[model samples]
Every structure is written in C-alpha cells, then in structure tokens.
Target: MSSPEQWTHPEPGEGPAARAAQPSPEQVIAGLRATTEGGAELTQLLTPEGERVASPQFDRYVADIDGEALRGLYRDMVLVRRADREANAMQRQGQLGIWVPLLGQEAAQIGSGRALRKQDMAFPSYREHGVAYARGIDFRELMGIFRCTDHGNWDFKAHGFHPYTIVIGNQVLNATGYAMGQKFEGKVGDEDGEATIVYFGDGATSQGDVHEGFVWSAVYDAPLVFFCQNNQWAISEPTERQSRLPLYQRARGYGFPGIRVDGNDVLACLAVTRWALDECRHGNGPVLIEAFTYRMDAHTTTDDPTRYRLSDELEAWKLKDPIERVRAYLARNGHADQPYFDRIQAEADQFAADLREFTFNMPEPPPERVFANVYAEPSAALDAQREEYLAYLSGFATAGER
Candidate 1:
C-alpha cells in the first residue's frame, strides 16, 4: 500500500536493526500449505465449487459478463488447455525439442489475457501459450518455437503480443522499458491510453532483472502490469523457498499497490486485470498482480517433477481445476448443457488435431533464414556471410548430384 511519497528513513533501532520476528520452520510449512486456499486479500469472484462470489469493487468491471461472455471465457480455457496438452504430448513423441505445459494455470493466463485492450501490449515468458491463444496468435504459429524450427514469426505490432522471452525474468525489463516509452510518448493518461502487461512465473521474482524493472517502472510511473503467476514451484523449489512474504506484498516497497487474486477463478483474473489495466491507462500505472495458482505438470517436458514433489500435492490442486469450475457453474445455472459441453470438447480436440498436423508438416527453414532478419536495416557484412554459407551448402549438393 506504500507509495513513493510515503518513503522516509526510519529512526535508528526502528528499521532492519529492530530484527522483525521470523516465522518458525513449522509455521512456514503451514503457511505454504495454506496458500492453496488463497488468503483474505485475494480478489475472487468464483469459488472452486462453481458458486459465484460477489466483490463490490471488482464486480462492476465484469458487470458485462453475461452468460454468453462467460461461455466464451470457458471455451477459451478449454481450447488453450487442449492445445497445451497436445504440445506436451508431441514433445514426448519427439516432435518438439521440449514443451512448457500450461496445464493448471489456464485461468490465470486466459482471464488476464482477454482483459487487455487491442492497444495494450503483452510481454511473456516462454510458458504463455494460453495468453498467445487469447491474443489471436495462431496455435500453429507457436509450434515452431517448441520444434526449434523458427523464432516466433508472428506480427507483434498487429497482435500486440511480443515474442516469448526464455531467459526467466528478462521480459520484465523489456516490458518496463517499452512502458516507459509509452509514457515518454504521452500515450497514457486517457481512456484510450496504452498499457503493457508482462507475464512471469513466481520464480522469476528471484531474478535481479525483475527487481530492476520494478524500480524503473515505479520511478517513471510507466503503464505496466506485472502479472506473476505463482504456480507454487520454480522447477524443483517451492514458493516458500522463494520468498518469506507473499509475492504481491513486495510491490509495496517498490511504491505500488499489489493485489493477490484467485488465479484459478477466471472471473477474478479478468476483473482484477481489467481494474489494473484501467488504472494504468489513467496513469496510476505499474500495478502488480500475484495470481495464486498451481502448476500441475513438470516445469517442462525435460523436467522430472516426481523427483521433488509428491502426488498428493497434485491431487489437492486437481480438485480446484480451473476449467471444471466454470463447466460446473455453466451446467448448474443451465447456461450450458451436456450437448454444449460435448460440442466444446469436440472443438478442442479438433484444435489439437490441427496443431499436431501443422507440427508434422512444418518444413525446415533454409539455412539463410537465420541471417534474414538479424538487423532491421541492410548490413553488407551479414549479406556477405549469408552468401558464403549458401555457397558452402551448394557445393555439398553439387557433389551429391555428381
């Protein structure tokens, strides 16, 4: 809750020297186990059991989410999860180098993703397939990334979704700078103002680049939303190992308001993100949202989560599955029936089928393609190197033909 104007040096013996009380190891473990329940500050509009919960402040943001809109959100999560699972399976089948599964965090990604305006930009860490889908990026366009065939070739300007950043929290720096540029260009402080949202995992908070981004964005009042999906683990490390306090609270020290949300609840994610984006567009700027969710799969296809965690934890999270809650709500309210659910499942299956077919048919890029876009402007040196490489390749082909 602290702001930049609130900063003042503490008196001697009243700051860090006071030695705040640290929680015992047992207390830490208890706290970690209880995070699944989402603490009191969490902004939630839907319960795990599919019941609707009202929030006086956030409800107005999602007041337009009638049955049709709710159904659309449900469909988004279903298709995204289906594509993610298919990608994961393809990796095991040797179709891709590796895959980052977005299995349990669908609501977190899709809800926040759908909340963005067309003018808003998004920067993502590698595991944001759901967000990409919501941004209108073809699922097939992403296949090349995991297959190691193409660096993302999508039109970022048109889609407002940047390329996936693989180096942990590196995208945070990129987004912060971009948001700063938005401020510099006088693109903020109006209803039509632009904002940027950067997505990273809970583990990324440990990286220095993320902290630097927080400081820079805060200082400039840049229109950026720091969306942290706290899926409970950074590969093998639990959340407790990452930070003593809930990650959202860290925003206070950086002079911004941070809020925790029930990441498993799509309605909550949408409402909170819309609110954050509204604030940024109006120049309040640089809010942080910690999405309390879980990751049900290995960090990547290459990771073996079984070596570090137990099945019991996975089972506990399964009961809170993001998709099922929406499905339940739809059915219980008669907004959708079994036939509707069946049609959606069929569509998701077809989506996966298309993705698989695309991967199977993907052609290898020519060697020269690597040098094609190294620079925006022409470079004689790069052109000369490309010609040399192509000539080398041609020599081998001619020898084979002979």
Candidate 2:
C-alpha cells in the first residue's frame, strides 16, 4: 500500500487551457469560472453585496420557512465557523496532528446538511465540520480523527452522518452502496422515501470512485443526491485543473440532472439542496449539485496556500463569505438585531469552548486500539503482530514515562 505522501493525484486530464502552457493561478480560476457549456450561470439567492436575488425555481422550496428558521440557520453557521476555527487552533497548538479547514465553504455544508431528513444518510469528506454540526454531531466526534488518537470514534449510523472519509472519493461509493441497499429494501417513490447524500469536493470528481458512484446511482436510479462542494481548490489545484466544464455538468453525461448553486449563499444552497433531496425521495433521483464556493484557508494545517494562490483571490472570496452575507441580510431586513447577533456570538463562543474542553480531556486511545477494529474475529497474523508489539514495548522500562 502507498503512504499518504506517495499517493498520486494526477491532474484532471488537461482542459483547453492545458495547451496554453503553464497558466498562472489567476488565469486558471478565471478560465474555470467561464461558461464552458451553454453559459449556465450559478444559481444564487444572496449576493456578495448582500442583495437577495430571485430564483423562481428554488424560491418555493424555502418559501414556507419563515424568518425564525433563517435566524436558526444563521446561528448554526456562526457556531460551526467558531468550531472550525477552534479546530484549526488546536492543530496550531499541537493538540492535533492536522485539521482540514473548511473556512469559506460554510454555506455549502450547512445548507445541504440542514436540508437532510432524519431518514436520509450523509457520507462526508473530512472537511465537513459544518455538516457534522448541522447533523447534530458534536465537534468532539471529529477530534479523534484529526488528533490521530483514533481513526473515528462516532457511530455514523446513529448520527445519520457517516465517519469522515480521509481517502478522497471513497465516501462517494459508500453512499451509493448504502442508497442501493435502501433501494433493494424498497425505499423510494414516496413522500417519505429515504435518500442518501454523499459529499465530496471538486477535486474528488476527478477520481474514478466518484464517477463510478454516479454511474451506479444512475443505472440503478437510486434515491441519491450527490453534493459536490466545489471549493475552487483541491488542495493546491483549482477546479479548472479538475475538469473543463463546471462539475454539475458531469451529471448529465451519467444520465442525471445537475445544477450549480452559489455555494456561499446559504439560502440558495438550502433551496437547491432541498429541491434535489426531494427529487431523490420522489424517485427522480441521482441528482448532482455543484456548490460554487471557495476554500478560504490552507487545505490542511500543514499546507501553505500562499505558495500557490494569489492574495487577490483570497480577498475577493472574503467579500462573499457565507456567514457575513447572512448576517448582513438579516441586519438589512431587520430579521435580527444587535442583541440577537451578540447572543449568537456568545453561543458560538460557548460551543467552541465546550469543543476544546471535551477534546482536551478525551483520553488518547491505547496502542491496542489500532488492532481492535481490524477484523470481526481473531486473526492469527494480527495477533502475532500485536504480541510482538507488546513485547517490543516491554523492552523499554521508560516507555510509559513519556
């Protein structure tokens, strides 16, 4: 098996710009944002300037949700962002080995995650902290994975959110298989039909697993929604480096409907995702939603994005920040006051504080914890290895002292 550093992330076979001979990051993102197809515009509800645009198709999906629900969504986003920031801080403070930051993609996660029904399941990528929060999965559940103290400590089935998949594109297949099972069990074509949603990034679309997942979902007509958080960059590479057309277009080729939404706009994301999920439940499923957003921080704690992207790109995306837009909209329309903002801020602080308290106090898993989940029954080879490991540990009298 290949180590993490040895994994080959081959570029998403060159687009038209590939022949242009090593374009700059700015040039790459510019081309990626262009209309590669029939000038399909991104579906937007809230603009960077805090304007509320009308989307006739998606408006009705959220029309029944009143101002109170909007306030709760905003509050959820604030707390999620605070938790994400704290997770990054934990890494910097040496409490974790690494953390994948989802700084600017808050709306994409919260919007889709909140749209899920109790019966629906979600398969997530590692940076889905916001989605985890929306699904009521506490930050501590993710801490184990980030800290390297445990691969995963949460019960995914219980939470309706699966364990975060570190291997890119793996969750795509997992969700597809789960949805296929739901189909085999006859969960489709009804108002209460169960659906499955899988989350991945623009980068994962280049992977074979994602493509196969799409094919399987389409072939089986599984009640599935493919949520792609196209956060512009897949680590150091931009979306254009992954595909020539916007990611949503790929769904059409697999014989399913696809749509692109402004990932930074919470309302639009919520509406679009709700629409897609409903379509899945009604048996017209296997929908693809390309959330057009940007990753505002390093891919992970160990990466330095400044080495690849320009300062101007970051500045531009900041104006369209998910939380800031909702906050601005609420204030503009008087849905919330300064007191409400202050209360939400306090709640967010408390949430982050609890996260820190729990993660800091969580006991590190024992060395044997690694061997416990390898199999359902005793394995002779693993048992021998475990004995050898214990014997090696006994050789050092000061092993536990550290």
Candidate 3:
C-alpha cells in the first residue's frame, strides 16, 4: 500500500476487456482522461474547481510555503500567461517567425522551476517560457531568438539555463552529460551540490536520444530530473500514439522511480519537484516525473489544432485552467483579495505592452552574424556565402538608385 503522503500511481487495469479496448482517433476527443484504482492516476494538490486537497507526502515538502508564496506563485502564472498571449499576438502580426505557446502548462513549468537551487541547471525544449520566467530571464533577452535577431542573447551560465534546444530530445543528452560532469567534479550527495533538470515533451520521448539519455543517467546515477510534460499531443499526434503504457512507467525500466502529477496543480508540481531535486542532490537521482496536462492552444502559432483535435476536448480542459484554480484557491482561502488580483492584471497589461514595444524595436541582425561562429579561422564556404549575401543585398540597393 502506498503512503498517504505518496499518492499511489494507478496502473492500467489488466484483462481481456482492457486488451480489447484501445482509444481510437475518435476517442482522442475524450480529453485524455484516465482513472486508477486509487481514484485518479495523478497526484493532485489542487482540484479543477479551485479546492485544495491534502497530500501528506507532498504537503510535507511544502510545509513552509505560506500565503505569500502562494500569492507569488499565482503572480508568476499570471505574468507568464500574459507574456505567452503577447507572443502569440506578435507572431500573428508578423513580428516573429513562430511561437511554441505554453498556454496551459504554466503550473507545470513555474512550480518545478521554482524548486531548483541556484546551483541547479535547467535544460529547456523550445516551449519553456514559464521556466525561463522563473529563472528571472529578462523577457527582452528571451524574445530575441524568436525575433530572428539573435540566437538567444542571454548568458546561459549566469541564468543556469541553456539556450532552447529545438531538436527533438537532444537536450536530454546534453543535460545528462552535464549532470555526469557534476558527478565527476564531486558535486553529488550533498545539499549544496548541483543538480540538472531537463524538459522534454511527450513527443520527444519517442526519439532514441531521449532513451539513450535515460540509460546514461540511470547507469551513472546522475543528479538529474527528467521532467516530461505529457500535454496529450506531441504536436498533432496524441500521446496515445507514443507509448504502450503511461510515460511515467518508462522510468521503472531504467531502474529509477517515476510519478505522475497533475500538471495543472502548481502546489503539487512545486512540492514534487522539490522532493525530486533533493533526492538528486542526495544521490538518489535520475527521477522521472510525468506532468499530465493539456495544451490549450495549437502547438505553435503556425499550426491549427482544429483539423485534428476536437473543440469539445479543448473546452473540457479549460475548466481545469491552471491560473483559474490558483486564483480561486487564493480567493477562497482569503490569501488574496480582489484588489490584489486587479493589480496583477494591470501589471500583466503593462508587461505585455513593454514586451511588445521592445520586440517591435528589436534591431535586425547583421548579415555577418550568421557566419560569426562558422569557424575559428574563417571557412571559405562561410566567406563565400557572406560575400554572396552582401552582393545580393547591394544589388537591391543599386536597383533603388535607378
């Protein structure tokens, strides 16, 4: 039996009926809802209706979190949502190439993000905007990559965050290697030792690189946390297509523990992540967390979800909106008032405006910028491409003179 503190992860029921039943494309509209013998498959701290529930194991981790911390978490979620909304709007206005919106995953990102110690590093996939926010990354610097101006102008080491990795599951290898390096440097098995956290989506798990990363991390007992946001869809493909069992179960095969948490429940995410990171620092690492959540928007601004996913499904998830539940919890418990909520909205508006202004005024990258890192000594191919680009640009200028 599982402890009250550690909510039991319900296994898929066995038998002929279970074997005969497979969720079809039509059933994808079922909103990815699954239940366990214990009630739900996920460990939840807050319900969809804004009610706070007790979890002994997770609650022990967050015992010190008071009303102020709860309010701060709410504020973080609000600001992140605002920034994401602004980014989407900017993309639609042609100010950006594309945006991978983290619309419904704010709790998943922010809660886990805040759990990291200063020495810990986080490796992000393309859509960890909320995590970037939690790291105190200047929103201005983060937008440069999407602006087509600079390839992430922020300092990776200082922020303890690497540049967003676009390749599927590639960053998992990078994070694993970094964690191994930390172990080599004798940074493991201590409260002050560094740890590594890597973010990858459900889709990325299908890639061999992620599998290899799992093997390496487990074998070495690297101080690492694999935070997988199972947002139902890996782009257009549902997570149903990616695994024979729940994504969390994969951790067992690698000789580590895995748990599923309600991604929308920020308190659970924070407590769970804190415990996991501590476990890593104490040398019981390479833990996997499957944050079960839904993506409320299209994969990117360029994609339309309507063609594949059902509207009803999106509506169903909306009731479980991460921000709303946090807000309600705050209000119901008298942790925050209406005036405070208003102020947050006002602040979010200002943030969006400021973000928009800076984004619009962002300077274009010079042609030479692309070839800057081609070689320590300039390569012939790079020089040729640079010269050709300059020549082509000049031709347009010359034509204007005529």
| Selected candidate, larger TM-score, 2 vs 3 | 3
Off by over 4 Å in 2: 1-40, 371-402
Off by over 4 Å in 3: 1-32, 35-39, 371-402
Name the lDDT value of residue 347 in candidate 2. 94
lDDT per residue as tens, model 2, 1-402: 111111122134433233434655545444633522112468988887777888779899899767789898899889888998998998899888899998988899999999999989999988898888888887778898887788776766777998889899999999999999988898888899999999999889999999999999999998899999888788898765566566788888999999999898898999999999899888898999988888989999899999998887788778788899888888999899999999999999999999999888988677777887777788999999998998887878577677
The Cα local distance difference test for each model comes to 0.90, 0.84, 0.86
- Give the C-alpha lDDT of model 2: 0.84
lDDT of 3 by residue, 5-110 (tens): 1212222341121222354332322324441111255889889889988987889988888889999999999999999999999999999999889999999999
Better of 1 and 2 by TM-score: 1
Candidate 1 residues 1-402, lDDT tens each? 121111122234433311234544444445545566666677889989999998999999999999999999999999999999999999999999999999999999999999999999999999999999999999999989889988899999899999999999999999999999999999999999999999999999999999999999999999999999999999998776677568999999999999999999999999999999999999999999999999999999999999998898899899999999999999999999999999999999999999999899999998889986688899999999999999999999999998
Which window of 10 residues has the lowest lDDT sum in candidate 3? Answer: 1-10
TM-score to true structure, per model: 0.93, 0.87, 0.87
CA RMSD of each candidate after superposition: 4.7, 6.8, 4.5
Which residue pairs clash within candidate 3? 5-57
Q: How accurate is candidate 1 locally (lDDT)?
A: 0.90
